[model samples]
Target: MLLCDVVTTSASVAATRSRLAKVEAIAGLLRRAGDQVGTVVSYLAGAPAQGRIGAGWRTLVGLSVPPAQEPTLTVAAVDTTLGEVAVTSGKGSAARRTTLLEGLFGAATADEQRFLLRLLTGELRQGALEGVMLDAIAAAGDDTVGKQEVRRAFMLSGRLADTATAALTGGAAALAGFGLTLGRPIRPMLASPGESLAEALAMGECVVEYKLDGARIQVHKDGDDVHVYTRTLREITGAVPELVDLVRALDCRTAVLDGETLALDDGGRPRPFQETMSRFGATVERELPLHPYFFDCVHLDGTDLVDAPLRERNAALHRAVGDALVIPGVLAPTGEQAEQVLADALERGHEGVVVKDLDSAYQAGRRGKAWRKIKPVHTLDLVVLAAEWGHGRRTGYLSNLHLGARDPDGGPPVMVGKTFKGLTDELLAWQTTEFPTHETHRDDWAVHLRPRLVVEIALDGVQVSTRYPGGVALRFARVVRYRPDKQPADADTIDAVRALLPGAEAAGRG
Candidate 1:
């Protein structure tokens, strides 16, 4: 495929604000990819490659030569290369990396920059495409024998580029034997909320654990080998060597555990959420140490616990790490007990509590009622009436969305907030494809979609603001989910939304 293929697909996907469309386009190109190496090279060389580390990046070059070739032969080789094009080239902090990218890839848009960043950062917003790649390998091989060979090569190599190359040169067995990478759990998952403990219990009798105020992480260890990753799968192995050392000392020979990392306060309890985040980046004080609190075991001693029940996984978790590495607290007998724990946690300055169902299986990348998060009174039901193009993982999808509440007097729905969080690739695609029918108007930056699509929104707090027509803004707004059972006219009104405001019941109800 030509570089134009990626460019055109990117433009169309961006125009429509659809993640699925962009992913499908990329997948289609990969399927028809005759010269896979050349295709990757071309895509990376042009528009997609000229941004910061996490966004869409240009195709990689220099692989044709020996791996030990001079630095100039590598894609990041020349000082003139885009990544090397310093953001503050003779300028200061005001000149963003985006500005540098625009200077180099004049044709690329903000959306394009976002895509390149994900590629470079290996965030790969396109989920399950690796599985598709495997299928493509099977189809591209000479015969069943050749396909099997390619699969095996991929399984052994454990790297994407190597897997693709093996299929092109070796065969399918290379792909089939593709093993799960370290720090990548077989049943990774996100959480969804239930209306209350009763709704959660309806699923089954579950062991509820208090959600801690910490960073979500996955830890992988094999004998002396150890690695750790964020929820998005970015390797932060260098950030917390203490965790690596702790997991290495565990009894299990090979184990994959899910948990949280936190920065403790002087009292030896968790600190603020922002403080935990600050521990990231290159310059965090290592001696201070981010402590990990293990919870679930996805893989233990060469056995896959992905399909196992939460109870089984928990049992495995205890056996693998013992009590030393797991989070300090244990199971609560009831919601009242859980509430007491939550109160104690908040008193210690923790954000809130997370309640988990004991029998729930790990559902990768899906947020459902299985694992519910309860923060302070900080969530809302808002409507999406308009959307704007987004960069990075959401470049082609309606990444940033405009939210609103119904009008009490049957007037236009009032705008409440805008958000890009609480969304998956699947949700992006669904909204992009479905939002158009509700389109009322369009501007270069945003589409004024018709009033519909009620989505529950989680918020940090309410603040008065003049920017929004509603005279307020929801801080840290995120989509909870599409309340499909709702109607546009049935959405909560601005009056109702104001009810969530503090100490203004008279004004809120008015």
Candidate 2:
């Protein structure tokens, strides 16, 4: 398939808000992708197959190469070229990389050039994200692979490229082949936000576990060798020797433990989110040790209990690890007991409690109503669009913050409201110095950014508003903290914000 063919499909996907339309258009493209299905799917995923070809926004914009008069670049050829660019590094490699980029962009037509630029800069928002692409992949396979089958494969494998290839080639059998590998990390199951403890208790017969504010870590153990992965599935075993040692000491020979890791203060209270996240450095930092709190054990002594109910998994987890590692929870609790659990968690400086249905199996990569997280205060992970300069005593610092929610349709983040609240003088100095690094342009009032930084914003509620494109605005919004561990893609979407309106039930399912 030609690169222009994929580019045209991407444009069509970006032009519509209808999810079925997006899925069908991409499914049509996948039908014609032939042997280059993996390459073409990765492109539609808003990145090259090799990932990060050493190109930046400025470098992409600086190119003066004219577009090709006709479509000539093939999908396979483009994939191979970017693969080479990903390996182009060392002394004097900048000039060599520039030459390769210039040649590639020089060969692309106008529309193809735009698509390439957006893809390289990680801004190719065509709504072909994992969820939509999963549907598309299922659709491309003659409907032989169901949605749940494809999701299971993708979540366990953690790569859309390989999942797509497997679904298209070997059908359902191939997808089923994707299972828990010893060293490989699967996507962690997440909890949906609940309006209140009372609301969550009414859902089902549940176990309410203490929800801690910490980084999600998945530890896989095979004999003495243990590997640690973040929620994004990036491996960081070497940086967390304590966690590795803890997992290595597990009684079971081989196990996959899903848990949260965070640094704690002297009083045993959880530290700030940034303080805990800062411990995940490239090198080991023993001063700030991260404690792992296991909630679910997918694999224990070769039992393969992932498909088992949470009640069974919790029992297995308790048997595998000591009480210090297993998170605190009450099985089959009354409403008052569940509320007390939430109170105890908050008293320990934890986030809240997750009322989890005990019978729900481990459904990775999807947030169902089986688990509901209820916090005393409502919080949303929003993106920082811009920061305005401060005045008076706060002069010379970026004070007021412009916040935005992620667009579900894969467009730029929509501005919901602005807040200068909850920022200390120290934070002011930090953003004033750090915000410039992500600046795209600067006006007299605020420094426009690339919408990359994710901030956890605590808001009272949202109201209907015509000021923002999303038709809603945050009420009494304040900065909780900067979520350095999260990415812009991980921020809460506009649909979630709309769910927080006065009349809405829950913020989101996932």
Candidate 3:
């Protein structure tokens, strides 16, 4: 019920590197939150607050200031209390927060400024406090809940404070049964192929589908109403009216489909991912036509097909969406055929291929070998060991991420490179709020973080380097996406890095 309670939980979660544990701690806190202010502060200050949670917090707090300037402003505010003032100007970094803090709080002692900054940054360093909140919820509930159920409720409800109120007044099941909803949008299943066809086959006998590189989207259509959501689950229905019309034209009455939406260039080919996302912006050409290549059907009519096996769901998808809106697939009983499809898809300028296990059901929020993504063997699964603070629009948040690979003898990771590309505005906001929790220590310029987050790094090539610790850095590194399935320990190591070198494999596993 106290601010200290919320602050303590945030401190504990931030101090740890285990995401699962951190999530559990936060979920527990949400269930027990009795103090409205405490619940609000804890959720806003916690780590991994991205996507729905971060957006919802920003909306509620009315922090009109862009995420880039938040750290400076928050830090400076430590000396003074700036009540309800909208940040109007951006002055890079050094001058911005100092000016705002001084103006907002007037003149304050140096120590007072420092103290205020700590609170503004949400680094209260409290411990096991979130669990107390969770206990409060469990105590008030009619029935206990699984951690997964708690997480699902927390995520689906959008705001922890609102959801906590619901849970306390009724029960968790009341919140959990909030009905079919949207959260962070369904992400596409990914695959990493084994070196040989036999090896790929040994992993699993899977149905191989054409992997399109267009924008990953989920279409929700009921009667003539159509809603389009990006992979991150932001509603973009108004942004693509043409696509809405296309969905409305479909014969199906109600359906939820997973697909790729793309923009066609003058040549009539599916445009690049960049071009497709460009249409999502406010200033982009509105008349640009977009088409969807639906791959999986999770719901049709009134039936929820999420529980059905992929083979059955694929059939349902065909019957509901028809072939025109769907990407054609290859029923491969053997890995050799899948290899052929992979080559064909790549030759056609597609990304690669997605290999789905026929018998596997849709496993939401879980990445297993059941759904393997076989991209070109060229890209590296790099870990985000550290990140540098951004400037301008990206200031405060660790916009530039430092990548690392496994060690030669299974030791600590070696730094490979850094990247500032392929980030969305939503992603930037999420990173700004979430990254600080993972900070191991900070310098005047950059923050050294515990090597825990793994990201799939797509690059032009691996080049020889003298600047980085790994002896090589990723050339033109860009984020393919965050690999939530990956653990920091599973991230590519220095041994893997050395193996990527010329003739290293023949010598050993680096």
Candidate 4:
């Protein structure tokens, strides 16, 4: 298929706000994709099949290649070129890559060049609109394949490109081949953020597990060959040999265990969030060894428990990994009892608790009410430093807020973090109207404001970070409400923000 056709179809998909219209447009593209269906889907999903080719705006901006007048590049050809560009490296590799990019860009028409730039630089992001694309893949199946089946297949495979090809090709039959496979990482099940213990307990009869502040890991063991994957499905098998060794020692011949791994302090409390994250990279650290704690067993000794109830899965988990390694939790607790569990988790220096419905099956890659995370809401009265103009659906709104904590010495507020989360339409409208009144300066990206307005912000916690002037950054911060009653002087101090870092006595995990 011509690259121009796919590009135009992507534009059509992006131009529409209606879900049905987006699905139909993508379905049409899928129908016409033929053998290049995978490549087309990946591109529209704003990911290259080659994945993160060492090219960026700085590398491409200098290219002076003239655009071709007529459309002639094919999707397959572009994919092949990008694949080649990704692997080009070593001595004088920069020039070699530029030559290749220039050749590819030189052949493309002006419109195709624009699309290629968007595709290469990682700007054309439609993956966030992935639900519509999944629907489109099912729709293109001519009613032979159901939406749930497609989603299941995608979740199991952890690759939308593969899902697209399967759904568009042999319909349900192709997707049926996708199942629990050892060594291949499936997307791990995610927990929905819970409001409070009482509210979460009201959802259903549930098990509450201590939500440890650690990295999510999915361990697969096929005989001696054990692989550990992150929540995003990247294998860190080599970096975390302790995890591999621990899983290999399991009595089961083959198993897929979902859990969290973290580094620990001398007191046996979990280490800071950054220290734990450090173990997730390519390099193994002897000083920062990661300890594994398995929670859910997906497959064990050839028995697939993915479709089983949580009660059955927990039994399987205990049978496979033993109770010593399993995450501590209570099954089917009352509301008051669940609150006790949350308090216990907090007192132990853990993040919070996750209330999981006992009867719900493991819904991989989906965040629903099956499992709900109840963490402490850490709020800070932070001064609004600036606001970035929004994009896409939030185009006209002043969306992302730059937050600062009051410097105790009183020089200036220290910039801590930025967040656009939890803002309602009413809040966005209010920001647009109210922010300009406090404006000190303006830039193309954001409107700078006088540090007079104090906004109440809720965060998961603070982590050690060099990105902020305060040497700490807010994790998962969102607007609680505007603290119009408070002044900048009344805002939380930078010392207060730093004290929230995990491992500090004043951090208050509970």
* Top model number, lDDT: 2
Clashes of 2: 0
Candidate 2 local lDDT, 1-510, one digit each (tens): 999999999989989989899999999999899889988889898888888788776877898899999999998888877888789889978888788888999899999999988888877878887788999999998557999899988888888988999999889999999998889899889887887888888878889999998999999999999999988888888888989988888888989999998888999888888887777765644678888999999998877888899999999999889777899879999878887898899889998999888889998866668888989899999999999999999989998999999886666798999999999888999999999988889999899988889999999999999998889999999999998777777888898899899867633442
User: Residues 1-510, candidate 1, lDDT per residue (tens digit)?
Assistant: 333455454444334424344445544655555555423422322222333442222332111111221111222222244445533454553345445444434333434434444344433323223333444444544464343444344433434455565565555444555555555533347565434544554565565555676778888897898988776456778878788888888888998889988888778787655466555554555756788888888788988776688889889999998877766444635657766766776677665566777777766644556787666656666778788987876777877888998764334578988898878887889878887766767888788875657787878767777998888788888876675434554466676566556655456348
Q: Model 3, range 1-510, lDDT digits (tens) per residue?
A: 433344445555656645455555665555455435223433434322221221222222232222232223332132122321233334553345445544543333333333333444433333333333443344444565444454445544434444456666556566666444532344334343334444445656567787776877778888988888875566788888888888788878888888887886776566656567777764555867787888888778888776688888888888887887778567655656777888888777787777777777765544456765666755677777777788997776668888888552223467888998987777677766777766768888777766667777777667678999768867787886775434554466565555456565466645
TM-score of each: 0.55, 0.96, 0.62, 0.76
For TM-score, candidate 1 versus 2, the one ahead is: 2
Clashes of each: 49, 0, 27, 0
Ranked by TM-score from best down, the candidates are 2, 4, 3, 1
Give the better candidate number (1 or 4) by TM-score.
4
For every candidate in turn, the CA RMSD to the true structure comes to 13.7, 2.1, 9.8, 12.4
lDDT of 3 at 399: 84
Q: What does the lDDT come to for candidate 2?
A: 0.88
Candidate 1: segments with Cα more than 4 A from true spot? 17-27, 35-176, 183-188, 282-285, 328-332, 379-510
